[model samples]
Target: MELPKDPAMLLSIVNMKLRDFYPTLTTLCEEMEIKETELTERLASIGYEYDADGNQFV
Candidate 1:
């Protein structure tokens, strides 16, 4: 799937996927064929970081 280019949109979509589908960021990245580091960095650029305990980015 093509990920959103905008950091804010990417943050929202990824968090939603993490919440509704994947149990963890690792799973989400694997299933989506995305690199976990890349995804996290992208979100982090926008001031979001993965909260493993909550399974979402904050």
Candidate 2:
């Protein structure tokens, strides 16, 4: 699937995947073809942070 054009929407989708599907950041990033740093930066811009152990945004 294509990444969302809106950053907030993108973050929401990513968080949803993390919460409801994926088990790890690495796996999600690979499936989405997104780099960890880039995804984290984008999410951070929207006030979300990745928690590795929890495997979701906080």
Candidate 3:
């Protein structure tokens, strides 16, 4: 699947996947071919934060 161009949208999609599909950060990153740091950084740039225990963007 194509990654969202917008960081906010990307964060939303990723969080959705985390909530409904993947069970862990490593699984999500591997499946999405995204780096954890890069994803978190991009999300943060758009004012989103990853809650590890919750496994969603906040």
Tell me the tens digit of each residue's lDDT in model 1 across 1-58: 9999999889889988988999999999989999999999998998888999999999
Descending-lDDT candidate ranking: 1, 2, 3
Pitting candidate 1 against candidate 2, the one with the higher TM-score is 1
Candidate 2, residues 1-58: lDDT per residue as tens digits?
A: 8888788888788888988889998899998888989888887887889888888877
Off by over 4 Å in 3: none
Residue pair clashes in candidate 1: none
Return the clash pairs for model 3, or none. Answer: none
lDDT of each: 0.92, 0.86, 0.85
Best by lDDT: 1
lDDT of 3 by residue, 1-58 (tens): 8778899789778988999999987799998788889888888898888788998888
RMSD per candidate (Å) reads 0.5, 1.3, 1.1
User: TM-scores across all candidates?
Assistant: 0.96, 0.82, 0.85
